[model samples]
Target: MMTGLHLVIARNNYVKKLMGLSIFQVSVIMLYVSMGKVHGGTAPVYVMGENGEPDLGVVYSSPVPHVLMLTAIVVGVATMALGLAIVVRIKETYGTIEDDEVIEKDRQEEEALADR
Candidate 1:
């Protein structure tokens, strides 16, 4: 809900869009982590009994989701950094971070080119 709200609240600002994207990424990470949890479940470590038989009564929760979410966190950070860098470049080029303003500038440039 918050993710959708952030995305919709600031449509014209590039920096706000990046922040919304970062929030959405975090929400997804949280969802994955939450789904990985199991009630009354232990780690995926197997113990051997006296007869060298693996314990059959133990319920092991998979660590795959948690590990994948960790990787996702790193990737999300990198993506956010790259996005912010792009926004900075856009601000420099357009003299504003507003999406509408940038589009207007591009349209004016195209009109000038058409007249030439």
Candidate 2:
């Protein structure tokens, strides 16, 4: 029962940490997206003119920030997925993913090995 309780707590902590990281990443992406806006500029799309030609006077904010942010988000997602996969493996291998418990268990193993 005690081990079960500890497992529950460890899972909760991992969830909290994951949520915190997600929020932080979202805020950063939002900042980048916001920077892509210009006070008086329009989107980078072509406007049709009477002659079926594109209007040449449309001002647009540079799409650099928006594009960069998109790339960052893609990379971030991939990295986050990899990290979570590793964490899951660790939890399975060690039987617990809690930092304190893992460290304590490691020390116990080291002492036991030394005593042999």
Candidate 3:
């Protein structure tokens, strides 16, 4: 049936949109994490030299990236949660979760309401 075909197309579109959004979120997190690392920073270990003095000249790796990454992770989770909420709403408003079905149903409802 035409409705079935429409549902298939709508579902595909929704899936594609979801995939794109996911990819975008992942890319943003990766970029933020990558930017957080210092170029030549040494590890944070305090090693004693042969002379019996602690080598403190070595710059420890920057922790800014790690901190930012944590923030990004939180943000990413929030975004995903919000996105899923929207999907749930869309599914609820429309009898079918398919894009085309929702549109068609909305159209029919509008027409019926208008006629009344």
Best by lDDT: 1
- Candidate 3 per-residue C-alpha lDDT over 13-111 given as tens digits, one digit per residue, 9 for 90 to 100: 554456556666666667776776554454555556578765555444557777777887788778777877787888777745566777888899999
Best-to-worst ranking by lDDT: 1, 2, 3
Return the clash pairs for model 1, or none: none
Q: Write the per-residue lDDT of candidate 1 for residues 1-116, one digit (tens) a residue.
A: 48646684757898888778877878888888888866555565766657887655665556999899999999988998998899889988989999899999999999999999
- Top TM-score: which candidate number? 1
Candidates 2 and 3, the one with greater TM-score: 2
lDDT of 2 by residue, 15-105 (tens): 4455556666767778887777665555557576688865546545568888888898898788778778877887887788676777888
Model 1 poorest ten-residue lDDT run:
53-62
Q: At residue 16, give the lDDT of candidate 2.
A: 48
Error at 16, model 2, angstroms? 2.8
The Cα local distance difference test for each model comes to 0.81, 0.69, 0.65
- Candidate scoring better on lDDT of 2 and 3: 2
RMSD of 1: 3.4
- Which stretches of candidate 1 lie above 4 Å from their native place? 1-10, 40-42, 46-61
